[model samples]
Target: MDNMFVLGIMVVGAFLIQSALGFFQIKHFGNEYNELKAEGRVAIGKRAGKLTSGTIIMFLLDDEGVIVRGKKLQGTTILARFKPYDKFKGKYIGAITAEDSEMIAEIKITRNTVMNAVNNYKMFINGEAIPEKGSPFAELVKKIKNI
Candidate 1:
């Protein structure tokens, strides 16, 4: 009877710990988001949790929205794509688009290929240089660009 009671207490303790951690994480991210919004940074998209260590990095885009791949999104231009590396771990690529370039729409192809598609796709999109010619990632990037 004492063992069972101990086991139940342990479970409850673990649950409370997890809940506390989750609450703090949400509060932290929420404050950061609100600050970004106040700074006029608009979010394009984001990926978080698990692989990202619960780091919610928002892909902040330019208000003007520049073109990258020669395609238009409805009425706004196709600005450069952005992706975060990991929680507080800098980024894989810094700049997605140049200061003043007239490209088109940038495509990020993330499907069943090499590790997590989200990270892989963002790496390609924000990579300093394109992947090598015949590599699988290169092939994926080619297909996305062509489309």
Candidate 2:
């Protein structure tokens, strides 16, 4: 009975420590984000990938799709949920300020079936096919290109 009581105390202690850590993380990053917003900077895109050590790397892209400005934060995680944007390296995504650089909140363009079809068509035609004007896919492509 004594051993079980001790185990319960230890478990509760661990949970409390975890809760404190999470609270601190939010306080720190939230302040940083608010400061950036006040300055009128936006984040265009976010990319997170693996680092050599246990540390994960995250980058914030500006409007021109450049990784010039971002808050660099280090966190311990075995694997990051973010996947690398492989479609095009250095693609032009329009003017994102530093305020848009929150690690937890990012706009991700999910590829749907229509997007896949368009990509497959592009590949088949050797990348030379004009999407029909006023088509939904064409509008989507335009928006992405403008981003």
Q: Which stretches of candidate 2 lie over 4 Å from their true place?
A: 44-68, 77-147
Q: What total of clashing residue pairs does each candidate reach? A: 6, 14
| Cα lDDT tens digits for candidate 1, 1-147 | 999999999999989987887677557556655654665543322322222222123433334332111101111111222233222122222323322121122222111111222243455556643333375567789899999
Steric clash count of candidate 2: 14
The TM-score, computed over Cα atoms with residue i paired to residue i, of candidate 2 is: 0.40
RMSD of each: 15.1, 15.3
Write down the worst ten-residue block by lDDT for model 1. 67-76
- Taking the tens digit of each residue's C-alpha lDDT, what string does model 2 give over 1-147? 999999999999989988887677667656666755565433322223224222212233344334433443433442223233323223322322223333124323221221322243334346565433355567789899999
Clashing residue pairs in candidate 1 are 68-104, 69-104, 69-105, 70-104, 70-105, 71-105
Residue 19 lDDT (model 2): 82
